[model samples]
Target: MNRRTLLTAAATGVAAASLPSMAAASPAMTVKDTMNRTALYRSSARTQLAALRWGSTTARGLLEQVLAHQAEVNPGVNALATLDVAGARAAANRADQYLARTGRTLGPLHGLPMTVKDALETAGLRTTCGSPDLADHVPGKDADVIALLRQAGAVIVGKSNVPPLCQDLQTSNPIFGTTSNPFSPAHTAGGSSGGPAAAVATGMSALEVGSDLAGSLRLPAAYCGVYALRTSRGSSPIVPTRGHIPRPPGWLTSSDMLTLGPIARDADDLDLLLDVLAAPAPADRRAWRIDLPEPVSRTLDGQRIGVWADDAYCRVDTSTRDVLEQVTREVRAAGAVLDESSRPVDFAASNILFQKLMYATSAATAPDAVFQGEVKAADAVTEDSPSALYLKSRTMRHRDWAKADEERQKLRAAWDAYFETHDLLITPAAPTAAVPDQSSVPAPERYITVDGVRRSFYDQTSWINLASPVGLPSLVMPAGKTRDGLPLAIQIIGPYLADRSVIAAAKALAKLLPTPPKAPGLMA
Candidate 1:
């Protein structure tokens, strides 16, 4: 059968029975009982890979468990935009045969079934960026990151949902609708990578690849109570953005600030994905092999950590602040030196520059008609209106963008100086836990209640915006849960191109913080 036909069969929940089953029926954790399935889903990727190698579980068996979990949870959460069961089964069969025949595994991610955000194109699968215009769009090839995953023996199960054109902070599009928080249905799974985060949170997928531009990857991982890494973004960038949307399919170039990384259930899993996905662009790899720096210290002992708990510009809510305070106190107790007085860069100034540059880059990909509309809209808006800043930035002159780019270089220098003294900087992932589902509200009109006071909906991204503009590696890990049972998270920012160091810091910090919280609805 052709690719489209296979996808159609998979969408209809057809099992690929014609393919070889790959494993003996007597193996542990068959798709027979909930208890065995629970054990399978709760295990980490490393543990699962060991099981795969030891013959305790087959690739096809694990894929069945993942599909069963997805079938149970995805309807309520709406995390996955498309699922290709037939294709996954076929791949799993191939993986099992190779292992059984050669007594050797494929690669680091051998037999791991995972999902990618729909913003990413997958060969032969529908990849709608939550836009009606591209509802039927299916790429003939995979995104660069997806290709890397496939090369590492990962089974691409499906594509996760994203906001339409990935423009909003909430994951909802006219096509896939809204993705609810895995912890609570009333709250949003933060977007444009919300689906990937939620899927990882609920064990629907073992790993997910999500892109970040203006906190798209980290914010959702924070909200969904998972782990995400915004890979190093400098001269030697990690993951390429060749197949991501917003540049539109078939376009070669993506935005400067946009990046792709992994979202998974644990920090170590994030590290595992970094190993598989981190590579230079195809053109650069012929001569360049990017090697990120190692962590400053393996443990928290004698480490200089910076704690920016809350800020006046974008103050976190009381619950979030409490969690931050607790985390800091724990870090200090663990023998790590904490510095609270040193500010890396001014929040207000950096945020302003970020907005100006981000808006300009976002506008670069807009259609001619849409660009003209934004120009007209900029002229009609009042100087002090909430939308004025965005419109002006979107319509800024090239010289103005050049000036902002220069300022960004200076900001990068300031971050480098700060990291010279500090091993890692920890901050609130957002102003609060997952905000209420605001899919129906317009982007500018949405509000988040911080300390019972209404704040701008965009404030959810203020803390997260710090790492993106300066080309730094930032990791978001679940800190704890809110009083009302929502997820609270903290961001770990390291020096530019220090991607491994950032994940290492996260690994150490995780030891001091509380055990990561599990979502209540499905995992409860």
Candidate 2:
């Protein structure tokens, strides 16, 4: 089917709750002892794979542990939307059989159980993007990244929850309800990849593949106290926003800035998953390949770092700024060269351009009637007003888009120039920790307070927008916690395609910071 037709069908399709059952049943496997479950759940993906390869733990045993963990905590957070219990067990059995017969492991993720964001298509499994339109939609083939994971011997257990069409900051929709923060149920987990971050944090999954356009992956990782990588554009062939809904089925192109990446419990796992994901697509591999450079400095000593804790354009909360200050002091004391005043490009101009491009890209999925309404609204406002800018961008002419494209190139050039002297740039992931769940409120009315000031609802993306437009590689890791014990995080922005350098910095910083605590009741 064509993309337009698929969208029309989705709009008129039956509700997900009324769809026919598509899952099959398999014989139940015996549950392992509590100690065994705890040990496997706490171990990293690399450790789990080693155990599976050595025959200390079978693939089936690891799958059972994940299922048991899901049963223990999923009810409270609503992270996993669909569980393919039968199919996962069958795949685990086959993996064990192959390992026993050949005396060798299958691939990097051998015998490891994992979950994917519901936005990514999974063959034979209900791949709803948390919208009623595609709630019963099942793809006959896996998304490009999903196929790669399966090839690497990763067992897919289920799909995680997401917002409707993944257009919101909080993960909640009519299809699967809301995914709460594991730290506190009253707060949001962050979206469109909220479910994946929550599942990884709560030990329900070994790792997950998620996509980011506007802080989707980074914010969720920060809110959940996990690690997430926002890869450089086109570094991986995983077309997340394309196979994902909002664009509908048969759409082969995604937003220009959208990139697919990994979300895990630690920086090492991010590196492990990136090695498996960072490769050219089948067609591109015929003519070329991608080989990213290694980190400039392995340790903090002699490393050049730039810190932008708070900006006049977007000020972060006091607690969030405190953590960034602490990180800066520790890194300086550890013999690193830190620059607090250096900044790349212009924040205000770059942010405006980013919004123009973001809103313009989003206009592709807007219905015809909605687009027309936006055009009318655009004509009614002053040209320089914020609302006018948003409306004009959303319903812009091709010529206007051409102008924005030129500005984007200039911004990219400015960033390239700045990276010549700095290894990485550090900033707050969001203005504050996870805020109270505001899913019931409309998008325009939502607001958050930072340092006694009421800011716009969209301010959460202000600092994060720094890396999105230029496609710079970025990582978010737990820096510390708020006074109330909520998770606080910082973003490490690397030079274009310097993914390894970003991860290396995170690994070094992790040693100086407090280890992230497990969410309450996650292991119990």
Candidate 3:
């Protein structure tokens, strides 16, 4: 069958029976029961690979479990936009046959089934980028990150949903509709990686690879109670912009602050995927090699950690602050050296600089007509008017971008100096937990309530923007849950090239917190 036919079959739920039956057929946890639990998904990527190697479960069986799960829960949440079951099953069968013939596994992720964000290019699968213009667009080649996952023996099942061009704070597009939070359909899943976060959280997919710019990866992961790593800028040789949309097909450049990384159920899974994705791209294999240093320390004892949970620029909600205070007390009790006073650079200045750079970089993707219109409108406002910053930055000249870039460099240097004394920095990932779905409203007009005070829709991303412009390695993990049962998360920022340190710190912090509760409405 053609790719389109297969996707149609999967979407209609007619492809579930095509999946191979389990080898043992013993009673196992039902998909609904698994969805209502706080634990990691039934089987993680690592566990599935080990089972594949040990002959306890075949690759086809595992793939079937994933597909069945997706079919069971996706109807309500709408996390997955497209399902490539036929192709994924074929890949799983090939893996099972190869292992039987050679008595050896393929790679680190051998036989694991996972999904990619809709914004990424997947060979033979539609990549809409949540835009109606590209709703039917399919790529003949996969993104660099997808290629790495394929090399590591991952069976790509389908694509997850995203906001249009991944521009909004919530996941909804003209094509696949909105992705609701798995815990509560009334709340948003967070975007532009929202679909992937929801899928990983509810066992619809074992792992996910998503892109980040302005907290696209971390915020969604935070909202969904999963682990996400925002890779240090340029640390991985894989070119993210090549297959990502908003740059358009065949476009060579991407946003300056954009990055691609893994989202998973736990820190160890994030670490596992990071090792596979950190390699040099095919073009750089001949001469370029990257050797990232090990984390500064494994234990929390004696480690100098900085806590900036709340700032004058963005005040977190009461529940979020409570979680941070609890984490602080626990980290101190564990013998870690905690500093609540020192801060790197000024929040207000750094945030302004980040917004300018972010808007300037995105202007490249704008059409000629829109670009000219923005330039005309920007000319009418005074240079110092705060309201004109967005328009001015979007239409800024090369000289202006150069000036903003210099300011970014200064901020990066300041962060570098601060890290000389601190091993990790802990802060709130957002001002509030996952808010009610606002996908129906235009992004600019949307609003959120934090501690009963109404704030701009854009405030959700304010704290996360701090890590993007400076290219710091940031990881988000579930810190605790709010009184309303929503997931509360913390961001761990480490020095540049210290990706492993942040993950290490996150793993340690995870041990201190209670297991997060599963989303409501799922059968026990």
Candidate 4:
């Protein structure tokens, strides 16, 4: 399809919700049309951009709609950590003027309004990362990813909330308090990208930039019933070279598993943001240019797919298992050759290695006193101690860390071998939908109940661990809802550097799956 035809489809088909309402200022609009315009704010980012391109709405008007919706809902959701109203409005005005005068867009995302995860720094915008110490912290320059987003003509409206240091599985900090699940205020939004997920799900923003290392990005996307991509890392760098938290501002080194990605309400939006963000960081731009490959297959028919529905080591709840079963059946009915018995790597072993390497990398920022304390604790603890693994991993020797890194390489090789025959792998994004609010409880003491039995809090990330350690492209999209009416989702994993393949699968599967239900009162 041509550009105008694509835009027309986006306006009429993908965003049926947007067509019910017209621009608020249109003299032809009726009272109902003006009332329905509130839902226009919830339209997909692509639809909004299409409307802007077609002269149906101005950038400033779209920003106003988003800001108004956020004002109405954020008090209850607490999704936004900061707001740059004046700056965003000014940028939107410039976008309007540029398009009107030049008859061309700034870029693919021209005039798009969205939020960034608090973990990512934005110039002149306070990014506390939900920490008290950095409550007043503001950067003078944007992070590499933020700069890229701006170059694509995205307006930085504000920053979303996150857990302190982006460490916990639940988003809560002294600075922003706790972000509630949009579906039910009683439930916790999964973290450390919880705020971004909630914001996207509830229409506070059209898209967001979030980071994931150990399910931070996908877990929340699953919990809130949105889409997120944990882009692959290979010969090229897919994330910012610096300015992410946990390394402190200005530090260049970060975790090997940690990666930055896009979060949005649909797969097409994920593709749109990924195109703008897949390039190298500023310092390497002159020498490195990324041209990620196209999808392996555009349709499910004739595709070779693998299903890792549930594992004995970390089983999902009944609801999640049912969703996986339904998805696999749909894939088979669609003529995809499905393999249900293939195990890419040993799940138990891979998770152990992931934990060790994750802790070792996180140890870089540990204070001298804390490292010394962990060393002492490691000497005193027995293998039976509950904290033994953590202490040993956090205080691991350089040689021990090297061994773990080597094991990760073998795991990656195993995944590559599996993909040699299979086009994609499907699994649960989490063991269950959004778990009950656990923000009031401390991290170590927290636990999630599965099958009416208490499971380790960290198990929420067990399924997600498979993709992170191996540096594969992973996409999470809503599958269905639990009996309780909460959102549930599946994870699609692709070969290393084949990011587009997973997104393509997601786009195809989205047609077969039920549209994720919007949050109750807020979306209504």
lDDT winner: 4
- What is the per-residue lDDT of model 3 for residues 370-463, given as tens digits with 9 covering 90 to 100? 8998899999988788669999989889999999998988899999999999988999999988999988876567899988999888889888
The C-alpha stretches of model 4 lying farther than 4 A from their native spots are 1-35, 521-524
Q: Please provide the root mean square deviation of candidate 3 (C-alpha atoms, Å).
A: 3.1
| Backbone-clash count (model 1) | 0
- Residue 65, candidate 2: Cα error in Å is 0.8
Estimate candidate 3's alpha-carbon lDDT, on a 0 to 1 scale: 0.82
RMSD of each: 3.2, 7.1, 3.1, 6.3
* Ten contiguous residues with the weakest lDDT in model 2: 16-25
What is model 1's C-alpha RMSD? 3.2
346-399: candidate 1 lDDT, tens digit per residue:
999999999888888888778899999999999899999989999999998899
lDDT of 2: 0.83
Q: What is the lDDT of residue 95 in candidate 3?
A: 89
Give the C-alpha miss distance for residue 467 in model 1, angstroms.
0.9
lDDT of 2 by residue, 13-78 (tens): 322221111112122322323423346766788888888888777787667667655775677888
> What lDDT does model 1 reach?
0.84
The per-prediction tally of clashing pairs is 0, 0, 0, 0
TM-score of 3: 0.93
Report lDDT (CA) for all predictions: 0.84, 0.83, 0.82, 0.85
